[model samples]
Target: MGLFTAIRDVLSGFKSLLIGMRITGREAAKPILTVQYPRETLKMPARFRGHIQLILDPETGKPRCTACTLCEKACPSECIDLDGLRREGDKKKSVSKYMLDFTKCSLCGSCVEVCPSDAIEFSKQYNVVSLGREQFAQMDLYAKVEAEAQAWAAAHPTPPAPPTPATPQPAVTPAASIAPKAS
Candidate 1:
């Protein structure tokens, strides 16, 4: 009975080894899914959310944020801090400084949804890395976007200036009429 039991234990161990080898073989035969990062980057899916960035208005070349504070209120993590100033001639307050503390962000999309002007959107930047936490603690979204806009403006040629219309001169009255009428 001891001999038979020992043989059975050996058979069980062999079976387990075979199963492991089979799985390994199958996996080894499959295509390599490893992306050689730095040399090759994987395209992020459309819905991939990395961080919040202010959207620039194409027409104005400025952030669409009106400094309404709706996004700040909607953020559950309370990572957003911003200020706005209404210029003397401006109708709405323009965002003066927009800061994002990414350390506490939950990526809940609450801020993006609550924004009435669609001023904010999730950034596609997925490779964010840093040596210290402080680098990401206070990201100035307003200044970053502003710098990008300036760089783009420098790269692209400005549109041609609209032609100024010629001013019309008043017609001269007849000399006879200009003189006092004989009475």
Candidate 2:
């Protein structure tokens, strides 16, 4: 009876090992999903989130941020540091400096949602790599937005209006002066 029990245990172990080997064999026969990295890049979907950037106004060709501080307040990690300058005789504050600390940022997208002017959006920079800690500290998001606006303006320039032809006009004769009657 003891010899028969030992034989059954050995057979069960062999069966489990065979099942594992079978799974490994099946997986090895399939195509590899690993990317070659530098040579081959993966296409990210539209909903993929990366870094944060400022949204620019199409008409003005500038950032739509009014420096309302709504986004700064909404950031849970306190990674957003925003600054604004109120020019002389200006009613509203204009964003002068906008910094984003990616080190502490959790990519929560909270800042983008609370923006009233719709000034914040995610950038499609998926390959951001930093070797040093200081490199990931803060990024000048405002400058990047400004550069984008300038580039867009350069690419799509408004055509100048055609000059109108100058035409000679006849002058109207003055009416004869009449004496005013006493009421």
Candidate 3:
């Protein structure tokens, strides 16, 4: 009885090994699906959420953010902080300092959605690497894009100035004109 049992166990183990090898052989015959990461990069999907950045106005070549604080208020993680100053002739307050604490940010898109001017959008920068935590702690969004904005502004023509009102002509009275005719 013991000899029969040992033979049965050996046969079962052999069968399992053969099954595993068969599966491995079949898989090995298929084409390789591994990506050579360094040589070949995969395109990120359109909906991939990355860090948020301020959108520059094409016409003005300036950040669209009005420094309204709506985005700051809307941020759930409290990662956004910014201020603005109303220039002497400007109607809306321009962004003076826009800071983003990326460490605290959850990339929730609240800031982008609450912005009234469509000022902010998700950046396509997927590969974010830093040596220290402080490196990503306080990212100045305004300063980062300042040079690009300046270059854009320099390249583009300024908007046409508003048409000035013409000088008013002297009012002519009907009686004064008739007297002048001297019939």
Candidate 4:
């Protein structure tokens, strides 16, 4: 009786293995779930977070970013960095250095969600192949900003000189205050 039971258990295990193999074989023949590179790429949604891309103000052509640094705070990876340009008054600061180390990015999209000025976003560009470490930390994001700063300065002329203030006038005492009231 024990020998017969052992034989039956072996047969049942083989049967179960065959069933699993059949399902795997069927799945392999079905349509693939991955996108083809350099060919049939899937269209990404408006907010499909991928590579980190700068958020630009369409009107200013510049960063449109007010250097609020909200995106930096939200970044989990801390790959994004921004330098606030120095300004005297109303003029905006030029970006001294705007960098995003792509290697460290986690593709979490936390930075994009917190951007108040819509100055941080993700791009559809997936091919970021790099050989060296420096290449991985590409500084591609700053090029557009540099050109915009130049163009903004050229198009928007400087304001005219601030008008001088007039000379001070003596304070005149009214007659009612100087003369005593009559009985």
Candidate 5:
């Protein structure tokens, strides 16, 4: 309320803080409960979910994404953005713009959970640093995959088979046509 009261409040706050410090100091002197970080990686619990990643199919050189956005909707932070592309023949559904902004991502793992095609996942890569915003925003999750597919297609183009000769068939005519019209 007054200048004296304000000074008294500040002193009380300092006393409370010192009391907390004393309690922590006592705990520190006792057997350490905190695990050593980095050198000794803490065991993450099964419930401790992590970030989302896209895995490519080795044989097909394509992601398992079937254009299903279950993960996108499932994410509370709305970090996963999937751009669905058309299949070569079908021209209906596939993923064109597969993007996951880990910056905005809260590492909730909702994307991994809801992925039906098993394309999106939690990668083992724990620490990835980026300088520019563009570098961090890695949209081309399947760049390596696309390149592989291109190489395969080029290597194994369909061979053109030689044309086969058709068998000759005898032409047939009616008896009346053979006798000619009786005009």
Candidate 6:
């Protein structure tokens, strides 16, 4: 009876192994989902949040950030450092420096949501890497935004205002055309 039980246990283990092998073979027949890393890259979805970037105003050709520091306040990781300089007699402040620490950032979109001016949004730059720890540790997004704004301005110059048409005058003045009534 003991020998028979041992033989049965060995047969059960073999059956389980065969079942696993069959499943694996079936799955192996399907096309591979993996793509070549560098030579062939996969496109990210539209909503993929790679990082934060600033929007620049076309009219002023500058960053749209009011530097309210709302984004900084909203960031959970405290990765955002936004600073602005107030002019002597100005009510609004212009962004002086803007930095982001991507290592700590969770890309939760909290900062983007809290921004009142719609100044910042998630960037499409998904391929971010650093050669060393110091490199790309703290990125100044404001400078990149300014440079892009300038480039856009140069590329898309506002067309010159249409030349004003000369105002038309009556071919003949009423008094001049109307002969003095013969008295």
Winner by TM-score: 1
Off by over 4 Å in 3: 1-16, 157-183
lDDT of 4 by residue, 109-174 (tens): 888788766776777765556678896575567675667667876888778999998998999999
Q: Which stretches of candidate 2 lie over 4 Å from their true place?
A: 1-17, 86-92, 161-183
Error at 136, model 4, angstroms:
2.2
Tell me the TM-score of each prediction against the true structure.
Answer: 0.80, 0.73, 0.74, 0.55, 0.51, 0.70
Return whichever of 1 and 3 wins on lDDT: 1
The whole-model lDDT of each prediction reads: 0.92, 0.89, 0.90, 0.75, 0.71, 0.88
* Ranking, lDDT, top scorer first: 1, 3, 2, 6, 4, 5
Which scores better on lDDT, 1 or 2?
A: 1
What is the lDDT for 44 in model 1? 93
Cα lDDT tens digits, model 2, 39-139, are: 99999889989989998888868788999999999999999999998878767787999999999999999998889899998888899987887867878
RMSD (Å) of each candidate, 1 decimal: 6.0, 8.0, 7.3, 12.4, 14.7, 5.5
Answer with 4 or 5, whichever has the higher lDDT: 4
| Best-first order by TM-score | 1, 3, 2, 6, 4, 5
lDDT (C-alpha) at residue 113 in model 2: 89
Task: Flag the better candidate by lDDT, 1 or 4.
Answer: 1
For residue 141, model 2's alpha carbon misses the true position, in angstroms, by 0.5
Q: Could you tell me the lDDT of residue 34 within candidate 1?
A: 100
For candidate 6, the TM-score is: 0.70
RMSD over all Cα atoms, model 5: 14.7
At residue 63, give the lDDT of candidate 1: 76
